[model samples]
Target: MLRRTFSLLAAASVLALTACGSGSPSSTGGTAQGGAAGGGDLTKVSVGVIPIVDCAPVYLGNKLGFFKDEGLQLDIQTATGGAAIVPGVVSGSFDFAFSNLISVMVARDKGLDLKFVANGASTTGEKGKDVGGVVVPAGSPIKSAKDLAGKTVSVNNLSNIGDTSIKSAIEKDGGDPSSVKFVEVAFPDAPAAIANKQVDAAWILEPFMSKALADGGTVVSWNFVDVSPKLDIAGYFTKADTIMNKPELTQKFTRAMNKSLEYAQAHPQEVRDIVGTYTKIDEAARSKMTLTHWTVTFDKDAFKTLGDAAAKYGTLSKAPNAGDLLP
Candidate 1:
């Protein structure tokens, strides 16, 4: 099971520009506190989605009519860039989005108003919560972690999980983490790049990594969690004002999302089948992957973990301690 956070690391490439299906709620329906049992005319909302395994809930919710049940017509757009969700959600082109926590936390530095109301997942299962991996070509003889020096390592984003994961690996093995070069590459591109020897090794995540190995890419060290056990991950706000003013909507969205998440928790194979429809990966690739569990409540401990890591790494501009992020 793969537990992916945000970044183009999780989705398509053109999400830098976003679109939504925003309109007033359908005249025939309205969603209330009783669960989506009797919603009338629906409000069409543009929600951002990326084509990754983690977003199975969003896709599944659509298939299951969870949004419509709640009088929401979710128009999901797959994202393409790391920092684009901020502009898109704030601009109102997207009513809500399934994006990583970094994009929003990074915005706090710029003084944007937003909030993360739910916890997505922590890596679990034998897949072991490891979401990223550093791999080399097969039979390349690059045995030790030190051999990564002077070699270009590709990541889906800069200073993100892919990079941080590798950073921890480098330091643990007596390698100068900063000395190794990191190139910004997407999840799918990593396979071809590494196969063609475009880069010595790449920090990548599922399906694609599965593909690279199938094509004979050697595994140098695929254990990304062993590299860094940081909260370098999470989903961000649907809208700043929604979190601030329409708290009900925020909670409603969370509830609906958890409904889908609950279904996913009980049905893993169904999740792969659902996510497979959206991702480029095939059945074999999907079957080989591990997954993370989805939960609804946003525990303070997790946010604290994220704040501490950000402060330690200077990822936050104001050095927001855990208190700043808590409600």
Candidate 2:
């Protein structure tokens, strides 16, 4: 029931973005503009984005006319998970995507020529306030990471941030991460999954993290900061083909995105408002929810930590060299 309610609200937000027209692209632009090919007019690009707080910059950028001023029209495509959006990016259905740094790594490993156009969101290890956590039901026997062994846990993505971060945390807590079975469950559905005992715990993020806690989910650990004190969690990226063939457009996107990032950092309430506009998160929850730190600067240290965690958790086939990954 809660999940259904969330879906309805998300649909309304998408309609709101569409109806606003100034920030988001006109829904009628597809046939009129000839399907993101503009023919020397404003360049139209389809952007794949997960409907999460980390994507605040893209929504804010659209709302603020940053992308419009850059001579671009964004066709926003919402997806439930970053992995689910990879095919669209690879097939050119989505020119760019708002995705986690870890998801980008997985795509690159699978031979997708993804490149970073701009940094998305990062964290300074604010445990109670940041967007990552390991959560269990209120009365679950799991009280710490060590208790997670020989149990099933849920992640929004299998080989991405949730699994890697939780594994690292478990290892640090003297537990065998490999012994824990990881499953994929969308964040929106995770709280109910926990409430029904479908999964023993969930590695989730806000606003789902807060929702889960509100639904009698206890915090096993919200220590993603301990995994990487300063973390670059998400980024805006596109295919290598786009960057090479459309250098000017890519640079323009970076500039506009950076401007939006600056604005998001400077205006938390405004960011929250934008988030509420595109998500089912209520205004009250929006005010209380911890927002992701918007950043244009990529953190090499955080990337290294993520790479190391992936390698240690057996997600990466080989150790990642930053040069090969970042563009």
Candidate 3:
């Protein structure tokens, strides 16, 4: 019933970004206009998103008409997973997207002409926060990552942050991460697999991590830092070409984002309600939620951390002068 109510409210509240995007091809909104083919008169912009609480600000902005006030009609496309959204956004299928910082840097290093314009959030607290615990069904006795050699481990996305985290957790405990078989599952569906014993362990994000815990699953361990200690978590990005070609539009977009982020920090509960509108989780569970930190502030450390990760993972063919990519 809450989902139904929230859905109806979401439908009524979200003002499409298309309704306010610049109608003129020449009215560069804020930044320097790029030299590519002129973006035609169209207020509607498709934004790519993944299903997670970090994206709550966008949801709140939609619910509160923030984008509309900024003259952008956003047509949000919830991605099935993080892997696809980066390419989709770069290819123009989406104007901007919420994606893992590592993927964006890897894509940028690969010459995708990407731009990191905003920060979604970072893992906070002394224990670190981006990576989540590795879970096993209640009392399975697979007490450590090392014990799971040759066992199957499921992650929300294959070879992404979840995989990276799982690898870290395994190696920390004297386990050979490569020996384990990795599987992919979405955030919302992981708990059922645990209940049915579909896999030995599930490496997941928070909130979902909370759900796995709530279900009586045993959590082995997790490392919450940026894949590297000083790394950034999630961020919003766009094609470099897009920013170069449409500076004004990009600025307006950033402005709206800044407002929404500030509001998110001020009202976490409202943000959760906005998140619940999309996730199928019940209201009671949603109310007990803890979302990660969100920031619109973009900086060099974030890029360097991402660049370093790419270099370490061989995602970069050659050492990149990370500063070359920053604003």
Candidate 4:
């Protein structure tokens, strides 16, 4: 069921990007100007985002006229994962994109010149009740992060936030972090993988996490919270050239996105409702799933801790310079 939903979302994302046309933004840094509800010409811009609950704010903000108020019309394209979204932004197929901080850091480490414009999601800092967690089967002997040593774990992406954070959590728990093996498994497919005993543990996020727990999966560690209470997981980012060449456009987007983040943080039910419009998560799972902490402020200290952990785990070549990365 989960695989089917992701397939549909991936197909829609491809079609949306194709329809928008790559590298079609005008000289003024917008695709085209169209009359908005506020009786003004709005610069239409494309934003690449994932189809997860993390991206609910962008959809809610658009519905609430936040983007229109900023003299912008958003062409929100959905990607199945951040990997696809990054390339779209770099190639100008998307004016901006949402991604986890680790992925953004890895891009900068590789000299991609990306800068975060607005915060996306953060850990709730509540162990055993965070937005995401590493889970083991109900009867499994693995009881804590330390037990995960030498066990195969599933993550949505390798060398990104999942494995890096889990390694940090394990090391903090007195486990041999280097001994833990990681395998790539999409979020939707993770529950089944755990149920089938294909993996000893799996790091999963909202909607899917709820499903895993329902299927008798036990949370061994809330990796994000275990890493750092102030950790900012993901945010909206764009190429550095976008900021330089189109300062006005960049500022407008940042302001609108900040407003969206603030709004989503304040209105929880609205965030749940909006998730259904973009993804296949039903109302039951939506209400039960843990929501991520949405904020406009990026936590530099938390980022430093995460980056240092990433570098130590070899996910990054070196600790990322938060001062240069965060706008």
Query: Whole-model Cα lDDT per candidate?
Result: 0.61, 0.75, 0.64, 0.85
The candidate that wins on lDDT is: 4
| TM-score head-to-head 2 vs 3, winner | 2
Off by over 4 Å in 2: 1-40
Assess candidate 3 and give its TM-score to the true structure.
0.75
- What is the TM-score of each predicted model, taking all chains together? 0.78, 0.84, 0.75, 0.91
> Which residue segments of model 4 deviate by more than 4 Å?
1-28
Error of 2 at 89 (Å): 1.6
Task: Write candidate 3's Cα lDDT for 1-327 as tens digits.
Answer: 001011222322232322212231122232222222353334565677876778889888877868767667666767654455665664455677788765665565556677767777666533423336677889887887777778888876554555655566566678776788888776667887887889988876767777887899877755445234444576778878788888877887788877888899789789878887877767877776566776666556645654554455444555456544444
Write down the RMSD of candidate 1 (Cα, Å): 5.6
Q: Please provide, for model 4 over 1-327, each residue's C-alpha lDDT reduced to its tens digit, 9 standing for 90 to 100.
A: 012012334543554457344344333365455646445567888888888888989999999989888888888876666566666666676788899998788877767788999999999988977999999988999999999999999998888899999999999999999999899898999999999999999999988998999999999989999999989999999989989999999999999999999999999999999999988889998999999999899989999999999899887889999987899
lDDT for model 3 comes to 0.64
TM-score result, candidate 2: 0.84
Better of 3 and 4 by TM-score: 4
